[model samples]
Target: MEVLKERFGQIGSQSVYSFTLKNDEEMEVTVINYGCIITRINVPDADGMIENIVLGHDTLDEYVNDPYFLGAVVGRVAGRIKGGSFELEGQSFTLAQNDNTNHLHGGLKGFGKVVWDAKVMEDGVLFSYLSRDGEEGYPGNLYIEVTYRLTNDNELSIHYRAQSDQKTLLTATNHSYFNLSGNLKRDVLNHSLHLKSSRVLELDKEFLPTGRIMEVNDTPFDFTKGGTVKRGAESDYPQNVLVGQGYDHPYILDKNHDHEIVLKDPESGRTLTVESDEPAVVVYSGNSLKAEGDFRGVPSRKYLGICLETQAYPDSIHHPNFPSMVLEKGEMYSSVTRYKFGIED
Candidate 1:
């Protein structure tokens, strides 16, 4: 572990920090303090060359105000809340509903805007943030901690722990746009993708679930085995098209002890395998990405990075069938997701 560089010094009352962590394989991980973001991750290609795969800005200001989700830790609650409200035990509570009719990513003052307290741990760093009751219209006083462990084995393990004084909804996930092939300007349509799921929640135009959990079998949403994203994206598949011409639905994976999502960079031969204990994962392709002008990505243009976010289903509080997101008093909430990086032999 080493401090390669500090991204920002002091901007008025705000302070930001960025440090680099190198493992035995020479894989480098740059983490930022603001929002506990992962600024960059440089890994080796098949031929033993290094390149940054995660999308990000060169300056801290770009991330501070960036709506791209870039590399920030997202929560209080990760996905969307239907109608910006939920009914729990006959009690109805309304939320800010930042996303049109839904409450997306914890509203306007989400975890992305808050600064996290940082500590240099043995192998990586730990970022912590506290959410007060009614902050962004959420309930309970919540204490959350996220640990980013960049291991020598080229694995980035994210561990989440939270506790609340009162029972409240809590689900946290890191929103890092990943383009493993180092092509940020180009779209990720050609990348090979595999998800360990057979059924998934269908979504409406607003990206909210349509209250139906359908099977991915014989549908374009099927990525049960490895397949390209554009295969079904171009078809008339109902859910695939509604997912904004890409992948943005939460797949209910099979209950096995294996990895859930595996992405292989055909050009670079860099493979990223994701395994999580979470019940479902939201696979969102960068459909809204624009690469026309100066705001393009690294080597590729728009829609290059894809996000595989591990968490409970969206609007879980309202869906009794989905796993519970409520953190009761005296009870601890713990979840773990790991990304193992390697090159194809």
Candidate 2:
């Protein structure tokens, strides 16, 4: 394995770097210091053709202003927090309500939008950022570390670690929009996906969890057996139609199941298997993607890609039954998620 760094772009006079982690097998994953964003994941297909799989921009300025979150790490809290407020340790805290009445993806400027201090490693790169005590309304000076490693087995693993001076809410995940069709040749509608989840949290009209867990028995939301993504993206079911035209719900992860999620581009014979320790995953069908000028010239439309964000359920603090999102002071918070790539037989 080799790690190479290059100039990405800049925010003012500060220089952002892009680190490429390449294995002997011709798999290369490029990540940038700004937002610890994954700019590219070049892998070989069945025919031995290598191409980039994840959605990204052509330049750094595009990423700095991107609203889609593209291939960045999202945090402080991974998803929506109701009304951008929470009570902790007998105190009340208010956050920036960027998403209507709720807070989405941390706040106006979350981890995905900040430049992280980076260190090059023998096998990968480590990105660290210190979130100030009052930054984005969180009550902690949180130290975050995100490591991206690529091994000879064609596995790209993201390991997250964090510690804070004050107890705070933190759930981090990589928000890479994947379209395994190589160079954006097609949308993800034809891709077959299987998520080992039997239940998904019900959401309100505002897209916040309604505190109810709904079973994914027969609806298009059920990917327990595996099926085409189009089945859900184009379904007329109420939940399918409720959130745009596709899915944006968090599915409870069945911990005992093998291969928590699997995505395949049948035409390219490319398969991606995801394994993670998080209790839930937000399977976004890219229902809100609407860019056409930045994606290496590919016309971006709805369902252009998909996001498998493995983390504790968003807004878990409000739902007593969901997994906890609190990271105590001096307590270690760590989680690992692996994405293994291969050619489907």
Candidate 3:
């Protein structure tokens, strides 16, 4: 394994650096300190040809100006907080309602928009950030560390660790639009996806979780068995229509298997397996990707890529039945999510 670092660009008065991690199989992953964003992931196709699969921007300016979370570490709280208000320890705290009437992806300026202190390790890069008390209407001084590692076995591992000085709500995940086909012009509708989830979190008209966990037994949201992205989207099922165009809702992961999700691009014979400790995974079909110019310098259309965001349930703080996202004072918070890349035999 080898690690290389270079100056990426300038964010305000701070200089951003990009670190590249290469393994023996010729797999390379590049990440920038700005938002600890993953800039590239070059892996081999069925024909042994290398291709970049993750969607992102070319320069720091594009990332700074881009609204889509593309390739960045998102959080403080990854999903929605209904009404932008939550009660913790008898205190009611209101957050910024950036997504319609709900608080989405932390706030207006989330962790994805901030610069992190980065350090290069033997086989990975470590990023650290300090979120002060009341930074985004949260009540704690949170210290976070996220590490991205490329293992020799062809797995891109992300490990997140955080601690709060005061009790606070915290959940985070990486938002990377992936196109396993290695063709940016094409949509991921043809790719086959299999999720180890029997139920999905139902959402309201506002796209906030309704605290209802509905079974995906016969619905379009069912991916318990492998299915194409287009088939799932084209189903006139009420849940499909309720979420707008495509799959933007979270699937409650079954904890029975080590691999919670598997995505395959039959054209390129490339496959991706997602294994995470998180309770749920939000499978976003890139319904809102209308990019004038993307990382490849081409116009991007909807469904050009997909995001399998592994994190805790959205709006879990308000639902007592859902797993708690609360981090008590003096308690360590840790989570791990891995994306393993491979080619079909």
Candidate 4:
């Protein structure tokens, strides 16, 4: 383990620090203290050329103020809440209304905006944060610990552990936008995407789940067999058009606890395989990126990088049919997700 030297002076007044950890195979990862963000991950392609596959700005100030959710850890609760409210047992609760008619990404101040305490160990780096009761209009005083481990075997593993003082929902994940080709200038539409999900949690016009777990068999939402992201995106796919752009719904993965979704850029020979223990994954195609700003990506228009967010189903707190996201007093809630990189010949 070596402490990464801070060469760039723009890390800001937030006491930024970087750590490098090498796994058994000799791969290296650079992690920063601010937002507990993974600043850079260097991996080899088919030609043995190492490249940084994740998108990010050069300074802490950009992430500190950016609302794009780029490469940042999300949640107290990761997805949307219908009507920005939910009932627990028999009590009705109102959440912060960041979205016009719903609660989006834990309201105005999410875990992404908070600075986390960092600790460097021989294996990797650990970042911790504590959310007070009703911090974002949610119950429970939640304590969260997230660990990032970069292994020599080409895997960037993330472990999430949380504990709540009261009964409250928990769904946390890292929102990393990846363009594996190392070309920020190109759209990811050419990349082939394969999901292990047979069904998707249907969402309404506003992107909230309709509480129905619809089968993806005959629908365009089916990515189970693998296909280019743009295949159904241009067709008359009902879910496609309903999402307002590309993917933004939570696909119910069909793996036995730990399954993977793979994406490969044939041109760049870069591949990304995401494996997780979390029950569901939210596949968002950066549809909201076209909002107009410097954050509009390098060259391509909208639908550039694809997001595979592993977590509990969206609006789980409001849906009784969905798996429980509840963390009762003294109970520990934990999950793991990994992004493994390699080249396909």
Candidate 2: clashing pairs of residues: none
Q: Candidate 1 overall Cα lDDT vs. reference?
A: 0.80
Better candidate number, 1 or 3, judged by lDDT: 3
Give the TM-score of each candidate.
0.94, 0.98, 0.98, 0.92
Ranking by TM-score: 2, 3, 1, 4
- Residue 265, model 1: lDDT of 77
Model 2 lDDT per residue over 1-345, tens place: 999999988888788999999999999999999988999999999999999999998799889878898899998898899989999978999998899879988899899998899999999999999999999999989999999999999999999999999999999999999999998999999999988889999888888899999999978888999999899777899888888888899999986336989999999999999999899999999998876554888887888889999989989988888889999999999999999999998
Winning model by lDDT: 2
Task: Provide the lDDT at 234 for model 3.
Answer: 85
Task: Look at candidate 3 and give me any clashing residue pairs.
Answer: none
Error of model 4, residue 246, in angstroms: 1.3
User: CA shift at 344, candidate 2, in angstroms?
Assistant: 0.7
Give per-residue lDDT, candidate 2, residue 335: 93
Q: What C-alpha lDDT values do all the predictions have?
A: 0.80, 0.91, 0.89, 0.78
Overall local distance difference test of candidate 4: 0.78
Q: Cα lDDT of model 2 overall?
A: 0.91
- Model 4, 200-242: lDDT tens digits are 8888888889899899887777888888877656757778887
Per-residue lDDT tens digits for candidate 1, residues 1-345, read 554646465556878888678888889998887888887889988998888888887776677667777788888889899898886567777888788888988888688877778888767888888888888877788888888888878999889998988777888888988888763534577778888899999787888877789988888788887888677557677666676567788888786349678988787888999998888888888776665433233443445788888888888887777778888875889888999998877
